[model samples]
Target: MPTHTPPHTPTHTRPRTPPDAPPDAPPSAPTQAPWQAHAQPDHREFDATLDVPYRASPGARRTISIYLSYPDQGRRHRASWQLELRTRKGAVLRRWHGAVTLGARPFTLQRDWDGRAAGAAPLTASGTYRLRLQARTGNTVITQEWPIALGIPPRLAMPAFRPLATGATHHVATMTPIPTGTILPSYTVYYGNLHSQTNHSDGGGDLAHCTGAQDPQSAALGPPDAYAYAQAHGLDFLMTSEHNHMYDGSDGTNPNADPRQATALYRQGLQDAIDYNAAHAGFLAIYGQEWGVIANGGHLNVFNSPELLGWERNASGQLLADTETPRSDYASLYSLMRARGWLGQFNHPAPDQFKVGATPLAYTADGDEVMVLCEVMNSSAFSHSADESESHRSNYEAVCDQLLEAGYHLAFSSDQDNHCANWGASYSNRSAVLVPGDAPLDNTSLLAALRARRVFATMDKQAQILLTANGHLMGERFANCGPLALSVRYAGAPGRTAADLTIIEGVPGRNGAVSELAHTADITFTPAPGEHFYYARLTQDDGKLLWTAPVWISQQSPSLLCAATN
Candidate 1:
């Protein structure tokens, strides 16, 4: 990590924007007129969410809430959805269904669950129960799942969080070491997938029939197999993130499973990845774990971890994972991640998930340091698109907007959560990682690029996008109270041209919406007296989209500014 000097801000009078404007040049007005929004997203998206306790006793009362937000008329889901409590055997124990309250502001649908089967029948099990919530939109299914502990002893209690938006100043001290060396340097864009699964746990099958979650460990392919597949498909690198719990041999349903076997399998996965990377000169094969579940919790891809993280144990109470970040305890996980210099991605997120401190998408200084990318889009999980024609995809850019606005810095990544072992082939989308020149196109540099947030999510593998502010590259944060200039650089394969491009600005910590500041590729504007972040977005004529990580800058009040000088 390296330190940087803050540029001087001329305060006598706000310097005119476009400082480079020729003295004899015509006057410059605001470009396309930047607009204002309070808490909406930079892109148009709709989302539905369900929140409930991660664990509840068999008969204890529990509360559940369903929320619908960000209305889009054209791609609207039926207001109606269903909620069901089911057994590991897939038998429904209890069920509920209804329409979400329709309004501009996101609203919640809540009810009490008494931990019993429908009609008061006693649920006679003390194991994990799956709570499934589902909704139908035009051609998509919006669903979420939460693992409810019926009788198991509590490990990570329902998380208690703090609102990160208001506590922005507390994290000011942690926003340093933006980049290790020169802020801007010659670089090359390397594209790859930071997520996907293999046979180590519920993935890895031939592309012909790898259409969905295969039985964990049932495939002839594993991490090395996936790496070979991705390399053949022209991916720069591929990480096979196995589900941690699946190491127990029961997809997280067998608590008494052997802890020794779980550790052995996890360690072996890491070794296999290391071996593959060593043998392959140009392609990187990474191994990590997809930690956590859906519903009350969200999945995070943990890379560079020494061992698998888990909460389950054998009947003898021995831990399964040698190194454990308590399951569902995201705060603890972030702290540990920072301590270990481990980087991760917020995988397939929704606004209502990943509630850190204040609310979902809220900030945590540790979270700010640990999470590098947020998956903005994911190709269809079970699609057998051996080619790049997979049109079914889910958009999570709104989640990215919410996280950035809430003060956690992250780059955008488009992933293919390959449950069917079809690595890099389900979609054309790729996470374009920008590595500083002179750095090797290996695991280390690729991970470094992610840590620096010098990355973008693109639906076109060959497209390139980067954002810079004040001559600083994307994923940069600094203190400024002067003319803030922004620029977008993009290129596409031989036949493609950018159809639309825009600069989007948002008030970090505003917990509000972002605005399209301009359509120009370059613009200079005076920033207001607060924290702000800006990003670049462009679309191709075919509707393929790409996004860059944002540049963040904060303005200090006079009192704080003077104290610093003294």
Candidate 2:
């Protein structure tokens, strides 16, 4: 590849300043910093509160939001919004009143208490409170309340978005300062999604007629159309991972269907993706299999495995797809992927899913290399929206965090999982890739990014967030000693500002809840020597969120390192 300055048009990345460059400009005065100064710990007083949530969650706030849309073809819908924080006995403590909009999906908003009563009131006490959403939609008004607690563990918070502190940042792509002593990568962010279902596997319904998920093998569009839709809608790539067992035309129960025919259908889907990408420059249309059933097993996306793996067969005992891997045996599936150098993603992970030896999320060493991504958030898989205003998305953040804590080196992805023909249009959320700045937006470069865990999950299509430790980027593992500086940088389209930024820390094998470590532009501190992982969460003023991939670090003293080498 030829080296060239990464132009800003493709990615909003700025190159690093040379060390000899002038001193940094002063930062603007802080605007009511959300965090209170903490008492720095003695270097030895570490890990004492690593598992304690209260030690980490004081004064924390969750980004709560709601989005309303009208898709009735030029018709108008309206909603006015306000909020009230009330005591358990129903006395209002804080009331955030009133922002109204009279349009469609543009009604995206976020609200949180300012830690006061009105203007200059003292801070609200730390206690459980009712977060009420007071809304007036068109001709009606309604109020909804959820239990919220200040200075409480995140999982117990009300129905607000607390992007799990589960993941890390990139350096080259962020154009942000490197934490003095670390080395990180310069990557360009590419936006797209990796999971969707088309007519190829009980999806790809026609927008004109389809309502939700279609009957297996009975939709109008296929993989190629999905690619076209995604590309035309401004995505850099889209992977349509079809359900493997659905190729037999009857959701794996029609024993009379020709297994060879089923295999050919799978191949045709693959060719469709190839042909689509060949015709469309810079847009990757990936075809792969979403293998497994959600009943007794969970689904995993095999992105590079060209040969379909399945257990369903027809009356002649002929195998569907190209092979007959035993169904629901994830351990065997993971081993095969390892041997074949294939990559996969855990889709909508469940506690009872992806088991080995009947243990869910059991740490499979072979799978540690094979599965690199997990779906942290997903829109309703069968949503029929095509205008990017889908509101019914499920938060798998806790589940994805569980995967990382379970000892899997997996990054996060926000999945569209579109059963509707809308492909990438059903939602604005995306799985972003930190593709090398010098590389083209193609399948190869994108796959390389995923293989390196250079990725992040974003709920907004236009926002960017990255985390880096020292000079190391998110999704990277490196050895370090001395001071540790973790930096998080963010940017969005014009007029958007970062409202909340948090650095979350966790130990890979601790299987404990993650903790909020810091709330600053960047963090600089000396931590006790050991293995740990850190990532960031950025909530934009518009209530959108971005979760970067986490960087894992193994720290040791120089003496220990030298001894180990000897």
Q: lDDT (0-100) at residue 295 of candidate 1?
A: 44
Please report the TM-score between candidate 1 and the true structure.
0.68
lDDT, candidate 2, equals 0.67
Q: Could you tell me every candidate's TM-score relative to the true structure?
A: 0.68, 0.70
Model 1, 41-108: lDDT tens digits are: 11123455555664553457777766554333233233557999987455898898765333233345
- Considering only N, C-alpha and C atoms within 3 Å, which residue pairs clash in candidate 1? 38-512, 38-513, 39-512, 39-513, 40-513, 161-357, 162-357, 162-358, 163-358
The positional error of residue 234 in candidate 2, measured at the CA in angstroms, is 0.5
Poorest lDDT segment (10 consecutive residues) of candidate 2: 43-52
What's model 2's lDDT at 20? 30
Write model 2 residue lDDT over 107-189, tens digit each, in one string: 34444434455555654465544556555643333334444445422221111111212112222343333435444444667
Q: Pick the candidate with the highest lDDT.
A: 1
